[model samples]
Target: MYLLIASDLDGTLLLPGDTFGAFTKSVIHSLNRAGHHIVLATGRHQTDVESLLDSQSLPVHLITSNGARISSACGGLALSEELPASVVRTLIEETREDTDLTINLYCQSGWLMNREDRNLRDFSQNPGFQPTICATENLPLSTVQKVFFFQRNKDHQALTRLQARLEQRLGSQISTVFTFAWCLEVMTRDVSKGNALRQLADFLNVPIQACIAFGDGMNDADMLAGVGKGVLMGNAHTELFQALPDAEVIGPCTDEAVAHYLSKHLLQSTALPA
Candidate 1:
């Protein structure tokens, strides 16, 4: 039996509009009661993740900022990784000179953005947290968790080209991945959902094979490949499907596939056959 259930928030656990249905909530509560640990592994910041789960308190371990930060279910920071000051400075300077992308930096204290455009405003509203507007050079780089680049024109091809260029320039100094169509995330090279999950499993004294995960983005590829039973949502990126071809495929997130899968498989069955 799996000891832990880790799920990505945006497109796997929560639906398109960042809403968590009652059915899903109830299932998670049941799982918690049944002695299974529940984890919310997301590309979001800690504040954003907490805001989304507002009022409805559940014991959910958080792996936020695509795994740059980890906190206990009760909201205590357990582990956090920060990008080097030099790296952050260089990246910010390069981004300013090389691209028209709207950039946001997440620190341990709060989110920082240079301007409040329509896209940034919409994103802020969704997360229910406003960013502190500040110059890129003035950001608190010592505690930087993650840097996000948002496409103003929403051109997938252009974003792809930019990502490639940034990766080539940054090389192994940073890790870059796309969490959404118009967004690219960069973090410390050591950070990833897989590494965070492994750390959490160690903290809980649970083996890696006793964990299960679900996700649907390129940022989630490492996590999906690392878990014992990595389930990909039907609406997942084609690249994810191609990369993890052997992973189980479930219905779309809007259909409450995680809830249904849990109900029919993990909850109902005694254990997965050897």
Candidate 2:
């Protein structure tokens, strides 16, 4: 049987403000040697993800921009989905009416922002790539892959209201998902980690039932449910548990749960009979 191992980056594989630890990297190398595909599915852009890896030579597939783009481990683009230009214009117009909202647009090239908002300032510090300050109207709307709305503080109510408004207005034209309490991600309606994983599996000639995924956010729900085995981090959002009660639970990402779980279970397991 062909097996695929897919995992989220932040809050799932790596702890807050941390990268892959030594033991985790060693185990990933072992998994790769053992003939399993490793994939990094994240809300980050491809450039950001690559920067985070630095000189690390891990052959890992990438599902980036919250699945707005998918690339092979060798850096071949497999899929690229962008929100409609009309929808982008509408979002910019409506969101400009809200003083509390700070928007960042991500394209295949890099990040773009209309103003130097405090939230953008904080994000730029560790975003791996800096956002180019430009007018929203000047952005390459046709090439935009994803849009991020960040609100200051943990204003959950404001985010919820914005999400509701966007969903109501855009309807089936776009996809909106909250990646954090104060952040909402907007992409094409067809973009999702789950869909990206499925596409990658098909391209690699691996069955869906041979895939396993690990994650900790609401955005990960579809991916967890779509895979053969879905492992939830112990510190996962409450909504994830409510959405996937049957998913296997593991220790928090801070504890290097992924390494431990792989060493104890998957790495030692034998392939099923053909």
Candidate 3:
């Protein structure tokens, strides 16, 4: 039976430095060729995710910005949710000068920043998402899909503090999580990778019981838990592993573990509905 195979990009599909190995390319290509659906669900912006798949052209769906935006197989956003304008304005005003954090805005206009962050431009693809450093007052608040904060050092303490601060102020207005310890993401309370996956399944006429998802981050928690089979990488963030302790644990992403498991399923035609 055909199934939906959704995966988060960073820590689940790619190897070190945001690169995919040849094995990954081959397995996904084979999977798509076999008629199982593949969706790139990620916390990344559309341009960044697009650049990563520009060469492969295998994805049938795209979920970006931690599910704040979803695109169809034709590669245009079909569903989107924007954060409250007043909240965006307040967030910028509160943290624009906070040197301890690198704030980013994923807007309909494009990926943006309150300040320059050369390090975060680490994607290994052209036409990639470039950080457009704009003045805090000039940020396009009305069209923003997701807002995030990060540090090059992957500083957990600072990000933890920032999460607490944002939650204290916004409370139910936003959903917050660490896709990784270094990056604290904020979206409308209604946005999530899980919800996007469900929406995509319904759009494609696939049932949730026929979906398998893989990931290794807290932002991925909902997606993993909501699927029929949720696979967690051995190298997943501690908090993520802790959150989904019952999830299937596979080898590390660096070892191309996702590819290996997928290949077995593809080759053996293992029935995954559980």
> Clashing residue pairs, candidate 1?
none
* TM-score, model 3 to reference: 0.90
- Cα displacement (angstroms), candidate 3, residue 201, comes to 1.1
**Winner by lDDT between candidate 3 and candidate 2:** 2
lDDT of 3 by residue, 108-138 (tens): 8887877766456553233465778887778
Q: Mind giving the per-residue lDDT tens digits that candidate 1 earns over 16-91?
A: 6778888899889888988899999998898888888887787799999999999977544488989989888877
Q: Where's the lowest-lDDT run of ten residues in candidate 2?
A: 119-128
Ranking by TM-score: 2, 1, 3
Give the distance in Å from residue 139's predicted Cα in candidate 1 to where it truly belongs.
Answer: 2.8
Give per-residue lDDT, candidate 3, residue 160: 82
Which stretches of model 3 miss by more than 4 angstroms?
74-77, 118-127, 151-154
Give the alpha carbon lDDT tens digit for every residue of 1-274 in model 2: 4389999988888756747877788888999998889999998888988897886787799999988899988555478999999988888987876667777899877888777777655454455678888876676667899888888665889989888988899999888788887888899897899999999998888998899899999888888899888899999999999999987899999999987888767677775322
lDDT of 3 at 230: 91
Worst 10 residues of 1 by lDDT: 116-125
Mark the regions of model 2 whose C-alpha exceeds 4 Å error after superposition.
75-77, 120-127, 271-274
Candidate 3, lDDT over the whole model: 0.82
